[model samples]
Target: MKKIFTILLLSGSLLVSGCSDWLDVLPKDKQSTDMYWESSEDVEAILAQGYSRLRTCVPYIINWGELRGSSVIVPGRGTKTGLIQNFQVLPSTSTVQWGTFYQVIGMANAVLKYAPTVMDKDASYYESRMNSHLTEAYFLRGLSYLYLVRNFREVPLITEPYVDDAMPNDVAKSSETEILELIRSDVHAALATNAAKETFDGTWATKGRATKWALYALMAETCLWAEDYEECVTYADYLINATAAMRPVFMSTPGQWFNMFYPGNSNESIFEIQYDETNYAQGSGSPSKVFPYGTDVTIDSYMYSEPMTLRLIDEYTQHRGDEISRTYYGSFAGTAYANYPDNGIIWKYSGMGVADREAVRTILDANYIIYRMADVMLMKAEALIRIGGSANWTEALAIINQIRERSELNPRSEVSADNINEATEEMLLEMLLDERDMEFAAEGKRWYDLLRYGKQQNFKYKARFKAIIMENNLTAENKWLSSVLDNDNAWYLPIPAEDIFNNSLLTQNPYYE
Candidate 1:
């Protein structure tokens, strides 16, 4: 399960280093009128920390994708063992104890509140740069809350961001419907907040940041979850029309594609987490390190190898029958990269490949990207298909083909109702998944895709996953999480018990019962 990310409601007023006052509405400790955010640097640092939280943000999506996807199910506690197995019935509150939402929410709230106050008093502080900085807080705060509403179905909508001792004894848990509505409201307000309206388009101080379009792109996604097809199309279209510079396309090789994730590579990204390996200890710690290639250590370190499947390597070509020589590489013998072995052993964990063991590492510079242009068009296409049906297939196919051509492939000439009918959603979804796979190959999309497709818990997943690992020489152990109950409880991750005892109004998820 994706760990729930909630900030602890501190009993005392916390003078924390990382988060800001925008989120912590009322720290239990009394504040000094003497201390207030005054400079752009102060505003920037506070917002930077808020932004950094997105990297380490542990929301429901991670769990939703990892545990509840279509192909896998909670085995009978046979092979894998843990709560992830019995997910469907797990209590939502179990995650509340250690969830990331509260912390983010707290920070976001603090930023939104204090940034305005900080920048408000002096007109000089309201510089164009500071305006955008203020807007960043809104974008982040709204984003943090959206993740909250999606995963748990309900949570305390804390605008003040912090939980003071005086906070109501009975904090209300908004229902999904209510929570979603609240999310939309916040999103709408974020869209309207006047930030760097004219200067945001330029990116020197503002590189790798959010604009009104970023919020719109996200709004489109949120609308899709609500099944508001029209709204989805509208918001996505707005983002696409607005951010014309961020055109996205897939690069052919893993090296080319993976390198794009290096920090500040503004190829297609509209918003991303800026990680300098040396400076930031935030986010999920570079997903690449945690993924298949990551060396395995049992709370320790040792080299472990995970290979990509022949099926995947095979899929890379797009065309089924390529020459045998070009199909494989690296350690696999008798293939292009080599020429001697039985099905090739894996080698993503190239820790042994590290040079100068004692050398200090600077920035690995990889970012977890959230929005890009290609997805905007595709999202638009999806909405078109839903709202306009086959009549709009031409537009959808056009978008898909534009992407294909970018990768040096041919575009389709026809996109008819019949063609739309013949090709299934599964096929289209595969296209989306494959695009995500290619662009974010090693960066980590496998788990999330599975969740959106509702395939993570399908029992059929294990064999499917095993087939890939065997061919790739990958290790399936760490990649897959085990569960406790055979039932859906495994699907619903355990809420850290801390939240249960504190929040009286919050009910336990059915699985917990």
Candidate 2:
């Protein structure tokens, strides 16, 4: 096994410089190999760099998770994003390069391999603190793989750090099942740590770092993706039950919902990538750049991506009305565009106000929340619905009603637990999906939700998913998209052509090939 000294020299050099606010403690000057890992601070600096690497993937997350879905539109006919929304993505699309995700995985692998040496070197670095840092490394690595597996379907799973240029680069792809099992294993390791306590006394660290609750959230979400309904419900219940007493994770009131984005790290936030403008900028990936905000709604030059679709806007209004809290103002802007409600701007990340757009964010440091209490609640509900029984349906309905109540919308009165027959069960499922659509619109979840819905039970709802694509796209494009999406392999992105050219073991996704 390589010693910590050499590991630091080989891997730690890549992490010495970062821009995150918490990463300020890292040494600006390069340290000698022997001097590194002498204290717990050294371990923490590596972990912080892992987090910073994760932040770089947010733009790809937003693009992969939303652009193809029926929520927001990307402008510019020849732009990469425009091609994606139109389902014309090729293997050479620049957005599909997943090197940043691998960088995050590399940082985590380094921490997991080298951080333990700090306990021996520093008297103050106890087992508990070491375990906490290790848990965070597992979280970051697992989360990055989750994103990769979801987007590319099959990807190279590299668990060890690349210590030198001589290391083999032609790693073969792992099946989705294999990748998911690794994620599960990582989650289990994270949860078993003694330092994986639920909260950091409601501080920013609680939401910013990995904790027991965050582990459970990841488990629940991954289980849902894997269609392990019982396991999903079990993990979700861990969070639901643990937070019951202290209520550490509660839904933010509608009036205060936007706070979850601007000046982020709200009570509902389980885990989010931290960003501070003065120290760390979101750069081109900033929400202001992706979904640019301006007083003039019709200026196409100002828009990098197209505005939120009117269908999404109508769904919000139908569910929550013109309430200033979440519907009209908090989630979207440009209500003054009465002639074209379809041009409503996504306001969640770039605006700060309730009931009205009070101020547009110029700093563009909004933290990209990965999981929150509301999303977890919906995951549990969807799991229960998949399990399928009157009691389970009833519980799921209650959860849905609770979320709707928080949003100041009426409880779903049409579907009842008593009459959960086949027809009503379908209705309940659509209702739950609609609630998710309304609640999480423009939050980079729409496409994944649609894909999950479509792919479940061997593409049972695939038509519904295709119809959504048709509904949101131009009539002319629908024929092409519908024909392309007929093959299930098209749903996942093509592995970038550059990666295939560089790696002998690589293979292009069948649809793209």
Candidate 3:
């Protein structure tokens, strides 16, 4: 089932075949939405298509989520990524489009729209299976909106299926708050159906499909974004106490932690997009070629994109005083670069072998882990601290220490049940932020962490990002990039010209306009 869906999903993701109203086509294979809604198998195929289309956005997700505020530098001057890294993104950058994500939303909406008709057509056949598929659809729609709201801020919220008679192209943007509410409602519907991870067939399906575990992780994440810290802690606590089978245990050993990316679908993964080399002919958009790690000096030729900043590498290895820890530095390497002697390579999701004797080869079947145990653990710690009070702070410290211990970093001492008494809330938050950068570097998370932290600290994140860009510049051409960063709304990329010209209802992000 995993291999079959992986193959079909990649192909279907391209055509998203049956979505007639959205594409304004006859759908060459005659899989038109109206005609295709006649069977449960048809519904399953559409759901599979949704998953396939999602894989298309893996690179965009990483690029948009991490590149903007990250400590990465794209060595070449004219590259699209270099423009993004320098905060000089224009409406024309090819990376500005959001069509792929909306395609996923359209397919998911089709499942939600037609699944009931599927149940009505063959009640006996659908009785046990309908809810599981419906739950998956709801979770996916909610997940799509979560991505949109985080990146785009306010996006059009479309729930109905875009059938032949009802295609609306001029829909206006919904408020971010409104989108969050709809997301919460969709997640609740998914939970009400109560689908278990084991119910999904295939080794990859168990972790790939939307389970109660994934739903709760989404809830905790959404609540954290909404600033409902109490609710965030509640959901995080549920995940922490969840059974091992439902919620995979966090892999603590260094070897397991590093291997988690290559032979993915690990016990630590909550939900990850499945990518198999044989099925995905379009290629996996493997980061290995970009964030490459090897004994070969040839690494310098193709791996210049997003080389980790010396500051980030320094943070990862630096322990107490000026002493550097070899354990933490094990995940990074100094790849030879003609321009710089100390260029750092991120091995986190490089798809390289973790074992000492395993041959280091570039891998294409690198799966993207969207949510994992370590991420939630750190989130739980942040939530507990955000809820305030002395007890919460102490508990939060212990949680952070747990993650640090797993990473083999020095753990904090629990001083008189207060941890660091001199530590203000800002100091505690900074500790958690630094730990996140160390643990999740090159995993497309650091930029968002900086945004969230910046929001918490009076927009200070903007100033920090500007400083990094200015300090790292080698030429005066990109110096003008710092001036654009002065506006608070500059944090979000402008709506692409393609989207704006196509729909008059859509407005460019104000700062960009």
Output the better candidate (2/3) by lDDT: 2
Model 2 agreement with the true structure over 1-513: per-residue lDDT tens digits: 112112233223333333354543333544544566677767777777677667778888888887787466655455777666777778888877788888778778877877888778889989998888889899989989999898889998888876655557687899999999999999888777667766654456678778777888889999999999999999998877773443347664666666777678887788887666656544456555556665454422222133344544554565554453456655544455544433456677777655346577777677788998889999999999889888898899989988877767777878765565543555777788778877777677878888888898888888887987777655126678889889889889998787788788988899888
In candidate 3, which residue ranges exceed 4 Å CA deviation?
1-30, 196-199, 279-282, 289-330, 334-343, 412-419, 456-482
Which portions of model 2 miss their true places by more than 4 Å?
Answer: 1-19, 24-35, 244-247, 279-284, 295-309, 312-324, 422-425
TM per candidate comes to 0.68, 0.89, 0.84
TM-score of candidate 2 against the unseen true structure:
0.89
RMSD of each: 7.9, 4.1, 6.1
Off by over 4 Å in 1: 1-34, 37-42, 58-98, 127-134, 194-207, 243-259, 279-284, 292-311, 319-363, 408-418, 421-494
Candidates 2 and 3, the one with greater TM-score: 2
Query: Where is model 1 poorest over a 10-residue stretch in terms of lDDT?
Result: 323-332
lDDT of 3: 0.65
